[model samples]
Each structure stands twice: as structure tokens, then as C-alpha cells.
Target: MTNYKRKKLDAFLSLSFCRLLSVIYIVHLPHLDATIEVTLRSMVASTFSMEYPKANRSFTSMSHLRRQLLPKTKDMPSGTGFGLMRLFTRKSPRSHSSKKKLPAGEQESESTTSTMSSTETTSIHRYDSGRRYNARQDIPYLLPNDEEENDRAHQQHWMINVAFGSNFDAPVQDALEKGIEVLDSGCGPATWTLEMAEKYPNSTFNGTDISPRFPQTIKPPNCHFFIHNIVDPAPFPDSTFMFIHQRLLSLGILENEWDKALADLMRTLKPGGWIELLEISYAQYENAGPKVTLLMQSVVTYGKSKGLNPGAAHVLDDMLTQAGAVNISSRRVAIPLNHGGKLGDLFWDDFKDIFMALYPVVGRLHSDLADIEEYKRFLDACKTECSEHQTALYWYRSCGQKPSNDE
Candidate 1:
């Protein structure tokens, strides 16, 4: 062969050898056996030149191939010899971290979950603070998704029922008894779903949340859980529900998204199906002192930083009306912070649960308190002030019906 031809062949062979090494290194990763090294050396020798026999060839090419093929793994610890093979690794689709790609024709799952209880569970994607929650690029809920939060939600449920004196204002029980379908948006722990499913065995309940915090080990036959984002177009077809319910989504819903949220609710329900939205806000509440107000203001500020309007709950009356619902009724249920006997105690626990769960995030996000201890002291003082002044917050429950054909 001409010198030029031999040189070109040698270069091509060098790269081919590097590629072969790349595959071998990846396949046998942290530990390369003697057999693999000998095979690699033989392949390199045979492919590159006839001057050296396969077995007698100098194995100096290993160092050369390492230099030519591998990319540095800065984040990875040293001495694994995986640095060069890292170049062939694929970046994680979401975070650009080093990861292995699944074999051809295989697709990754959306989420994976492990359960500790039938009432509450956690997905692999969960991020725990005081409670478990999954961080998403879309929603900004801070609470955790464990059994404690689940029980807390159940307690809150009772407190809400006591405050309102009924499970619902609209004839949801009537619809359910007739074997209708129900969709519970942001159904944390599926407490409402389980209860309603047992109460109305004929009705099917679909619960959805961004986190896999729903009951898994034990669930009613009619109740199902779906991981979903309410801001997006719901998975179901338009007008599929008989009754759609949502509560306490104010943590994620923003001022502008209210219109979209209401619109989505309207799109989700059948004609004349009732939609009840319950939200808690600081609008026109009584007796919150500087510490309480400060904590509340910090929450509002932190929510705004995340592009949410914490106070948007107060404006749902207009938004719901604009979304093309008729016979809209708004009920503001007052929850005594420190005044109403056993009811007040439950509400206090509910409030404290939220405060405790969010306390860490609040300190990081917003703090009117001086330090950790000061925040604790402030909370203790708020409890006293609440009882002395009959401090209470209002839960605005607004029910609306889609306009029927007759309308």
C-alpha cells in the first residue's frame, strides 16, 4: 500500500479501535477483565496493521485509545477509568445529568410509586420537606404526601364539614345515588373519594393530583386515582362528569390562571352538573395580630414569588360567573381560629399542621420572624391572640351549575 493510503488506514483504524474500546468499557464498566483487554488488543492489532501479530502486539494502544475516546467525568469520582466512556453516555432528558439509555424500542414510565399505607403513598419523584411533595415545573404545592398529611387532610375535612354543616350545598348525594360519576381535582390522600365512594356505592369517583399521594394498598372498587395536572387539558373528554369538586387548590392557582381553571372546570362537567370550589383565604377575616398577619403576609409574598396569587380565592365569584355557569351560589364559611370550642380546636390543629408543614419553606422563602425560635414563639403567641380575640378565617365555598339546554 502507498504511504498515504497506509496513513489514512491507520487513522481510520485508530478511531475504530477507540469505538470498539468504548463499547467494551461501557459493557464491562468499572471492572475490565483480562479476557476483554486481550480481545480488544487483538482486534486493534488486526484492524490497524500486519506488522504485528495479534498475540505479540505491544498493548500500548490502550493508553492511546483512552486519550482519544473518553470524555472527562468532572462530577464522577476519579480512578474508575470511566471518564473516556462518559462521552457516549446520554444526557437525562429533563436535567442534563449523566444517565444510561434504555435499550432500543423501550419507553420510560411516567412515574413509579411505593406505598407505606392504603390511605397515603409516595412516588419516586417525591421531594419531602416536612411532608412529601413532588416538585414539578408547573405546580408549586409545598405540602408533603405521607400518612400524616393524609390524616391531617381528614381532620381538615371534618372541620370543614362542621363549619359548613354539610358535605355539599348542591345535591351531589342525589346525583351520586342515581349512579353518576364524580371527579375530585387535587384530591389529596383521596379522603373525600373514599368516603363518597362508600356512601354512594353506585357512583364512580376519579381522584387526580400531581403527586402519587393517593391510597394504593386499600381503595374502594369504584374510586380510582390519576396523576394529572389540572392546568392542562384534563385527560377525559369534555362534559364527562356529573359532579366535579376541588378544594384548597389556592396554593397552586394564580390570579391569571383562575379564568383557565374555571374554564377547565366547565369543560370537565356535564350540563347542569354541579361544581363546588372551596378555598381558604385571608380576605375579610377577623383578629389576626402582627405575628399572625406577618406570617400570612410572608405566605402571600412567597406565593407571589412563585407567580401565584395567594389572595386569588377572594375573586372566584367573578371568575366563576364569567366561565359560563348559571345559578351560581357563594357561601363563606367562617372557621374560628381560637374561639369555637371543639370546632376551634380542630381548626387550630389544621392550621398548625399547615404551619408546621410549611414552616421550613416559609423560613427559606419569607420570614417576618427573626429566627427559628422566634418563629416558634410567634406561633405560640398567635394561638393566645386567636382565643382572646375570637380570631377566625373564612372558607368561601362557591357552587355553580353549567347552563342546561333549556336555559
Candidate 2:
């Protein structure tokens, strides 16, 4: 098998094992923070089979990863993942051409260093078991072609189609036609960016992330990767890109930085180009049901304890509008965190739903957390609320265009 394939297999195996350990740890550790760390170490160990010379390296590194976990705060600013799905999902964006090739060895070293700086560990080897693990862990989740699940997810994606239809497709398609430059910030494993590059061979697709886990490839002369933190100044200059895409970046970015990031991204956009914002609000509460609302609050409080505030979703639309994008609007979608009449069932089901959905793509890109079952009790309560028809999840999707000022 190719080295890449082998690494993928190793990652799959390691993640599966750590998932099992997480199931066990959840029973012992009541604290979400502690359990998340333990789960991360187990998975990392599975990747790095050989014992490191440093006895506590895994533990220390896991802590470092935790610090970077940036809690999803209220009104957390949007990131690249949210940007693409909102702005560029319907079609490929325009891109510039480049034939530059960083040597294979040099590229691998850069990726390793990048991962270490974020997690504070110098242990991952490129093309070794750990790197392969990264590849494997990302592929299945983002591109799961299971016709049934894709249908379900596509259905969810489509619910917003009517509300944001033209805004979503036109810019990406326009960019592809014009060879405009595109940026995918916080791109996890290049799922969206790489797919776009393959579809639009004439355009350049730039993917930036703190981890160097992207595939080192001989680009088709139109794609590249960079290590950048989106909250900071981007690498490119003003009006350099035709489009910028950011999604789910709530953790690392603060509220004040939203305008700055907006200005920075606008500087890169060509006249009349597009920018998209993808976010999920955390501010859900029941209207009248007493018991159900309390249970909802408890479940939501747990998320808040982990630094996730559902309220951020509500604020992003206004922020994007204030930044001066035209035709700005947002759609709210609900993912049933609980469907049945049991709290354990509700929380556990949604927890597993999110894990099963995202783990294949990016779970391993970050640290591992609690077991699928740990949230069962919570899910059951949520289900009861849902059965009473008192449960709701408010997720926000918003996008806008840079005015064609030159026109």
C-alpha cells in the first residue's frame, strides 16, 4: 500500500481505539475538560506506537491541545469552514495559476512543525504512522458518500436553498469562470478547497490552516496551501482575492476582531466579489414549557460550560451587514438534538450524530472528547422535550457581496 494509505489506516485504527477509551473514561470523569484531555492522549498514543523518550510527553501535549480548544463563546466570529459552505458550496470559485512546488521533504517538515506549534509537541512524523492517521481520519467524515446520509445532509443544506439560493451559487460559479483567486481559511483536511480546485483547474485555490495536515501534492498548477491564523493579518494584500470563505471560527476569534477580519478579507476581494459567513447561534430557549425549558437549559448549559454559546449565531448576520456586504441575509436551520421523549436518548443521539457526522472529517484534526454514550442521560431529557414539541436548535447561515464599486 502507498505510504498515505497506510497512514490513513493507522489513524482510523487509533481514533477507533481512543473512542473506545473515551467511552470508558466518561464513566469515571464527570468533568468535560478532564475527559477531553484523557481521550486525546489515548488517541495520540495509538498514533505514536513507539514510546517517546519523554515519559509525560503525551500528557503535556494533550494539555497544550486543550488550551487551543478555544471555547465557542457567545457571538464567536465566523471562520473559514463556515465561509465556504455559505459562499462557495454550490460551485467552484475562480483561482489564479501557480507552478511552484515545495520539495516533498521540505513540505512534510513544515506540516510537522505546524502541528507541533499548535499542540506543543514535536512527535508527529510525516509519511509515518501519525501523518497517515491524519489523512485517514479526515477523508471519511467530510466526503461520506453513504447515499442515505448524504441525502439527509444535503436535505439539511437544501432547506436554506430557497432563502439564500442565488447568493450561494453565483459568486463561486462566476469566480470559476473568471479565474479569480479563492481562499479557504480554517480548511479542515482540504475537503472543500481541494474539491473546488479539482473542479476548477484554471483557478487557484488557497487553503490556510495552523496544522500542516493538507496533502502535499504536485498541484494541477492552480492550488496551494499556507499556514495562517485567520484572526491575524492574512498573507495576501488588498483586493488580491476574488472571494474569501470562513465558517465555524467561533473559538479563536473575538467579537471586536470581526470588523478587522472583515476589512482584511475585503482588502483581498476583487470588486463586486463575495464573502460568506457561516455560524450557529447558541441562544435557544423554550417559549412556554416549564420542565422542558429547564431541561433544555441544562443541556445548553453543558455546552456553555465547554465554552460554546448558541447565541453567537444570532449576532453574525448583523455583524456581516455592518461590515458593508450587500444583499446580506441569514437562514436558521434546526438539527434535532432530540426527537424522541427521553433525555438520555436526546443528548446521546445528538452527540453521536455530530460525532458520526464530523469525526470522519476533522475530529482527529483536534483533540478527542467524551464517549458517544456520556451524553445519553442528557439526550433522554431532550427527547422528552422534543416529543412535547418544545425543543429547537437555531443555526445561522448568512452571506453577502463586495459592491462592484468600480462599476
Best TM-score among the predictions, by candidate number? 1
* lDDT (C-alpha) at residue 9 in model 2: 63
What's the C-alpha lDDT at position 89 in model 1?
A: 20
Q: Candidate 2, which ten residues in sequence have the lowest lDDT sum?
A: 87-96
Model 2 per-residue lDDT tens digits across residues 95-208: 111112332443333333222122111223222211122232221112222222222332232233333343243347865766878887765445446546666677888988
User: Candidate 1: which stretches are off by over 4 Å?
Assistant: 1-131, 365-370
Each prediction's TM-score versus the true structure: 0.67, 0.49
Best by lDDT: 1
The CA lDDT of each predicted structure is 0.65, 0.47
lDDT of 1 at 132: 46
TM-score of model 1 vs. true structure: 0.67
TM-score (C-alpha) between model 2 and the true structure: 0.49
